[model samples]
Target: MAEMTQITPFVNCRDLAAQRRFFEDMLGFTCGFQADNYAFLRRDNVAVRLLEVDFNLDDPARQQMVYIDVDDVDALWAELEPALSKLPEGRARAPFNQPYNQREFHVSDEGACLFLFGQGIEPSA
Candidate 1:
């Protein structure tokens, strides 16, 4: 049996340039490399390099998803609040009271894919 250690959930995007800008400028992801139809992105400890799906080699049909784990979901979302609000699909998760709870906000990238996620945790005393 093959053991799984790490996995990348890749998604297709329409434009590499546009998605690059959004991932870097908006999402604050660090650029790894860039070619004609492909680019790699990294953010902090998490990484799932992006590929600008090849039309000739593969299909560009839509499939929306990208979930990011963070130390503090609410705080991370707060930091992303302003820019997120501008996103067409951006929807705020209702506020709640709990110790280390789940909070999520959905937003669209430049290519209009429903991407970006935040998972937060409140430390125990």
Candidate 2:
């Protein structure tokens, strides 16, 4: 079988610049490469590519979601809360352990992509 290589999501957003700004300033992705209509960004070991498109707010498309497994959810929240809270709807939902056994919170970036940062829930004492 052919060896499987990297799989990076190519996101389509309304504004490329806004998406770049959000990923850089808000989500901490560094632009590794760029072109007229697209950019490749990376943070740590994760990579994502963004493409500019005429996105419709009313389009019944599957929402884009990114799950970031973090070591300290609380610390990440504290660092980002102040900036996130200022967005029109960028408020980060308080972290809660899910039924699937993960503690996570959701934050929406400028392009309306939902990012869920999570950690494994500790067992009750």
Candidate 3:
């Protein structure tokens, strides 16, 4: 059997420049490669690809969600809190424990892609 190496998600956004900024400035991802309509961003081991697309933002079907597993969700959230606070209300959420045995922090980018950062925790008693 071939061993799977890594998985990178391709995200569609209305504005590539703004999306790139969100990934880099907000999420701490560095741009590995970029073109007129596409960009490859990486932070530590995770990677994401941003593609410029013409899509209806009003359509709920066009929204995307990406879940990222982290070693420490709270630490990551603290580092991003200052920047996240500048976003409009409801764009960022504080880290919280979930019934699923994970602590998660949720944030939405300018393109409305929801990114969830989570860390595994002991199951609640």
Candidate 4:
């Protein structure tokens, strides 16, 4: 059996340049590799693949989503809050603890893919 190493989500976007800028500028992701049609972006251990695709209005597409596990959700939120508010639909909801015991916040890119940055909270002492 082949051992599973890692899972990287591929997101389809209309413009590679815009997608690359969003990840690099807004979310602090570094571009690992880039081609005309594809880009791989990384931050710490998380990697996201972006593919350039033509948007079809006739056939509506489902939004792509990625959850980035972070060491500190609040700190990330504090850093990202100001910039996130400027993009179209880029506003982030305040971080909150979930039933799953993770404190998380949601932000969307210009491409419409949602990213949830979260940190796992320990049980109360």
Candidate 5:
């Protein structure tokens, strides 16, 4: 049997450059590779591929949700809060405790892809 090592997700966006900035500047990811219509971004072990596309934003099929497991959700939120706050209304959300025993922070890029950063926590009593 072969062990699965990693998985990278492809995110479709209308503007690759804007998505790149959102990943790099806001999410703290670095661009490992970039081409005319695509870019590979990574931060630590997590990676995402941004691809330029022509699609309807109103289409239900175009919506995407990405969940990221982090070591410390609060810490990560603290670091990203300033940059996220600069985004348009509803683009970012503060950290909050979830019923599933995790603390999570939510944010979305220009392409409307929702990114959730979460860390496991002890269940509430």
Candidate 6:
């Protein structure tokens, strides 16, 4: 038997620096690695890699939507509320807590589509 380390998501973004700022500002991820066109960030328990590319023009051609689990949904939503409401257009944005789950929301730095899954319906051990 083998133990498994967690696998993290890497999203291709249009601007590396802007994406770094978004992750840092909203998620508290600090720069883990960087040079020119790419960087790594880790905050709380979430690890994400931002790759620079021009796959989007009209809107970000977001290839990845990473969802992370968190302990508090409302608190994070409060932190992100002002910015999330100011999206230009055509970006899927919302903060929702249904009977089955709880979530906050945001866009990737490239305006590439992304969001957070703060809580979920799960069975207790």
List, residue by residue over 1-125, the lDDT tens digit for candidate 6: 99976666777777787778877765567998998878988877678777787666345344556777767766676766666555457453566655554555545445554655566645333
lDDT of 5 by residue, 40-107 (tens): 99999999999998878658788999999999999899999988989999999999999999999999
38-76, model 1: which lDDT tens digit per residue?
777877776655667645422344556676656676666
Model 3 over residues 1-114: C-alpha lDDT tens digits?
A: 999878899988889999999888888899999999999999999999999988786588888899999999999999999888888899999999999999999999888589
Question: Whole-model lDDT, candidate 6?
Answer: 0.66
lDDT of each: 0.64, 0.79, 0.92, 0.83, 0.92, 0.66
After the best TM-score superposition of candidate 6, give how far the Cα of residue 116 lies from its true spot, in angstroms. Answer: 2.6
Candidate 4 vs candidate 5: the TM-score winner is 5
After aligning candidate 6 to the native by TM-score, how far in Å is the CA of 53 from where it should be?
1.7
Which sections of candidate 4 miss by over 4 Å? Answer: 1-3, 57-61, 122-125
Off by over 4 Å in 6: 56-62, 82-94, 99-108, 121-125
Q: For all the candidates, what are their Cα RMSDs to the real structure?
A: 5.3, 2.5, 0.9, 2.6, 0.9, 4.1
For residues 1-125, could you state the per-residue lDDT of candidate 4 as single tens digits?
A: 99986789998888899889998888889998998999999888889999988875224466677888889999998887777777765356779888888899998776768789999998655
Q: For residues 1-125, what per-residue lDDT tens digits would candidate 2 score against the true structure?
A: 89975667877788899889988877778998999999999987778899887757336574577788888888888877776776675356878878787888898765647788999986654
Clashing pairs in model 3? none
- Where model 2 places Cα greater than 4 Å from the true spot, the runs are 1-7, 55-57, 123-125
What TM-score would every model get versus the actual structure?
0.68, 0.82, 0.95, 0.83, 0.96, 0.71
Candidate closer to the true structure by TM-score (higher is better), 4 or 6: 4
Task: Enumerate residue pairs that collide in model 4.
Answer: none
Rank order (by lDDT, best first): 5, 3, 4, 2, 6, 1
Q: Which pairs clash in model 6?
A: none
Cα distance off (Å), candidate 6, residue 43: 0.8
| Candidate 4 residue-wise lDDT at 45 | 80
